[model samples]
Target: MVTEVRGFTDPQKEEYFRKRFRDEEQASRIISHIKKARSLHIMCHIPVFCWITATVLEDVLETREGGQLPQTLTEMYIHFLVVQAKVKKVKYDGGAETDPHWSPESRKMIKSLGKLAFDQLQKGNLIFYESDLTECGIDIRAASVYSGVFTQIFKEERGLYQDKVFCFIHLSVQEFLAALHVHLTFINSGLNLLEEQQTSSQTEEHFYQSAVNKALQSPNGHLDLFLRFLLGFSLQTNQTLLRGLLTQTGSSSLTNQETVQYIKMELSENLSAEKSINLIHCLNELNDRSLVEEIQQHRTSGSLSTGKLSPAQCSALVFILLSSEEDLDEFDFKKYSASEEALLRMLPVVKASNKALLSSCNVSEEGCEKLLSAVSSQSCSLRELDLSTNSLKASAVKLLSAAVESPHAKLNVLRLNICELSEGNCEALSSVLSSQSSSLTELDLSIRKLQDSGVKRLSAGLQRLNCKLNTLRLSGCNLSERSCEALCSVLSSQCSSLRELDLSNSDLQDSGVKLLSAGLKSSQCAVETLSLSGCLITEEGCTSLASALSSNPSHLRELDLSYNHPGDSGMKLLSAGLKEPGWRLDTLRSRMFPEGPGGSSVASLLFAAGPPPVCCDLHRPSPTLLISAVSAPWGLVP
Candidate 1:
């Protein structure tokens, strides 16, 4: 008992054009032209726009020159109007339709339909009852002509509960017709209905200012396109297409310039993101890309960093980023201005990108609320987000974590390294890692003060069966032996999925390494890469690690013991495990600090564990085998 209808997707849009033209080359030509005007191609998602575009382009391509084809939305609507009028003449008079020859009767009917559209549009009514039409002074019988070519006026087949109702094929058509009526009334009588309170002043500025204000006041922005169409009428080009319907086709060029300035200045005001984007669209409709072009100039010149971008320029940058065909990749905030406001204005850009690097911009708490929408957006392609060096509050972290735990989240990698993370933030992220819906596989919370408490909280999540994390980085978290106990539990658990662990630059002295060795020896441990660089380890710590390698060396493929004072005694113990009969560790990475005397002997003997034959020369130490860089897997010690 329920029915659903939706607009065309990209494939469906192409399919409609292919089916309508029935010529691959012809359809491709029309498609190519629309694609160049990105805004027009976006609108083709609607079936009604596609139909109207086909109608206008079909004749334009055949008769009109290259630049004569409609580029903006308003121009396209105007051409559709002229085409529909000419079709009416041909269908009834059986005459060769050279141009639109509007009879008095046809003009009267169209004008009446316009009034009906304006009246219904104000009340936000898409469907009209029989009484609604009569109230607008529209003769029900005369309205049927629009059904033939205009595609909508009275769709009697929509028998909702056996009652006659009327509506446009699309809401945009109604808005366009309504705007047409307003333009006609204004150019003819200098009357302005857009103004809530009528003023004696009839300046062009007053008319457009009132329209913009009214559009901004609407809660859901229902009047945005209507405002675009209304302002677009000021241009002489859009007006010429409706010359037959207008009392006068001529418009003052000064008035057009004034309207453009008024709307462009509104961009400097503190408007919502939605309002800013709509204002940009209105500028496009007015054929004013001066602001956008100016920003493009500054961007290309590489002088954007030398000066602060104004709010108008910032919005234009957002518009330019979104308008490009190169979406669905990555958005790096550093490429644009480092201003937080400008970065936040680019939510739509982030929504389309698969990866986003928003590091070090110092996003505020309120900004995190804005980012929550993008993080949780089901339609967004965002898979990886790096918020490194952004000092986020615990409350902001909670909001982001909740989104990461949502079923709609597609986020796979989150890097919060050097983010001033706290225990409270760790608790929030722990929930995300434990969530069944979470897709997070890699996490970096490096260079913070998580200590023992944060690691314990995180260990709970890592031990959960639903946790998807395989790579975890906790470098410079100020960890100690207490932290090791909690992580050891996670490493030995059957539910843990941890494969790569980084504890570099933490103060996990000999005691911590012993507890970690207990976890490493467990048969359930799946860790392939373990980094313990700059952990203040000693010979005692190396002894426990040797036993762990001897007990279980099948899983550990990479061991990093760079920057530690493992003396001759520790190297003697470690070499026994590395040379065990069932040894499988191929990537042996160790950096030993000499103790007392004969430390060089210990360094040369340490290579006996697993280095290649070239690196195993005891007489000369190979530079390739003595890597101390904890930045990555830098070298191989045998």
Candidate 2:
């Protein structure tokens, strides 16, 4: 789908103006003005946009003494129309600068062109024939003048058979002109082209409401930009720029605010991400930034953590993240609010993020349905998902299991910790991991009560050659040696890809340690980090571990034995194992012993195992290994 048709660079744009304009200072001044306006500068990249900018900015800068200047898209297009008319008048009609730009004849021509633009745009037809022009009341003779006055705006070309066909210079030009046509039709004659039904009391609010409805109903969002321009034209300053086209300018400010309010309310509805983002754009065009500004203020002051956000603010925050160009490496759901409604409202962020952190958010089964859509979607960027602590049940996780088993999904890391899983949930997870399509490398099921039965189910997946899991965390899972027996099978299997295993805070006594050490000595064991901290292990466990390390301990780099009953005797076994020159243990975390000579000798021996073997002081409260599984802040677009 990609083509070599990228727009002009900044230097190319400046060079374009310099070549078009005879006076270099004037060209420099115009480039300076375009640079000041970020949107305008970005638009100048397109070659046709450069022409439109040249036409619009040249006149506006010269008439710098104007009553009001153009800023929004609606205002700029309005000025573009007026400037085209004025140029035609002076060049061909010998009119002065002070001449009334919108003569009756000029209005006729522009209105006809607007009608053509609107009608053709509605039909999704960018190119039209002469017959199509006549339908919009543009005779062949008037079309000549149309091509002459705004040749670039309304272009003429030959078809395959050498017959003449026509289209606007760009699709954006057609959309802008169509929006102007809709706005002027409503303003001058009170005709609602969007809807066939006319209410008894059709205020500016209803007309705009109809326009919004029509745009939202378009399946492909064909009228999205047109709707933005149409709504933006409701602003009073933009109306002033359209003075030549308007016959009525007395729209009440109260009614405009009502329309803005209506748009914000629409934002809170359960709309698709694309529609929600477009509605936010419409709100911006109306100059209503109250919701957006409030969210920004909350995020800036760290007050979002303290207060609850309304539905509208949640949509605004989503708009900020979805529309940003920054590399949103993470989307933290709980960072905003833990409300289930907020999580559901912002599910679109999951599809947009490289890694989404939705753990600990007050998510529901319905939220899982929404999350499933995002994850299974073919174009989503989500690779890592942390859905921990939402307290979801088996049925909810089964829904997520569907996405995890899909070949198209790119999910690589999944954290379902503390989600209240049963044996059935583990069965579903086991199937997902066993699927050859699954790409998950790290699975964190920590803090769950998946007992021996559940661990047996997961062991089926760990033994599958198709399963590619490298890090498996079952910390605080109420496991016993029976569960460790199942894991021992997995660790000894050459098919197991597990390099890191966290079985911390378990009831795995010496029996479990011995079971695990037996697997660690397997030539196929790839585990580099093993965390058995707080497990009920004493001297007997230490003897087994030391003997296992003495035999084949090259694969085991770091071992955690903290907060256990591994007394002085166990320490001596560990110290003896450390003194062995065969193994290369990088980090060893054991209990902090008392200050007796016997305890000091064991401690110093374990520490001073002469080439300064890697060790860890279990005293410093295990440097928070994870970053709350939540990070990467968002901001409001300026």
Q: Which candidate wins on lDDT?
A: 1
Q: Cα lDDT for residue 599, model 1?
A: 35
Compose the digit string of candidate 1's lDDT tens values, residues 382-455: 89999999989888899999989878778999999999788888888889999998999999999889989999
Candidate 2 Cα errors over 4 Å, as ranges: 1-177, 198-201, 216-223, 239-254, 264-277, 298-303, 319-330, 349-356, 378-383, 405-410, 434-437, 463-466, 547-552, 567-570, 574-582, 592-638
For candidate 2, the per-residue lDDT at 389 reads: 83
User: On residues 1-638, what C-alpha lDDT tens digit does candidate 2 reach at each position?
Assistant: 21334577667988999998878887787777766554456567788878877778778767874434455556677778788878877887799989888777777777788889899988999999999998998887778778877775787778999988888889888998888888788777777888777544577888988888898899999999899888887888888866766777746788788888888878777666667767876776776768777877888888887667777788888866664445578988778888877777777787878899987886778778877877987757799999888888778989988898876678999998988899999989998888898999999999899999999999999899899999999988889999989998998998999999999878899999999888887888889888987677888998888888877867877788865667777866665555456666656676432232433322223223321222334222233221111111121121
Count of backbone clashes for each model?
2, 0
Candidates in order have lDDT scores of 0.78, 0.78
Highest TM-score, which number? 1
Q: Relative to the unseen true structure, what is the C-alpha lDDT of residue 592 in candidate 2, on a scale of 0 to 100?
A: 34
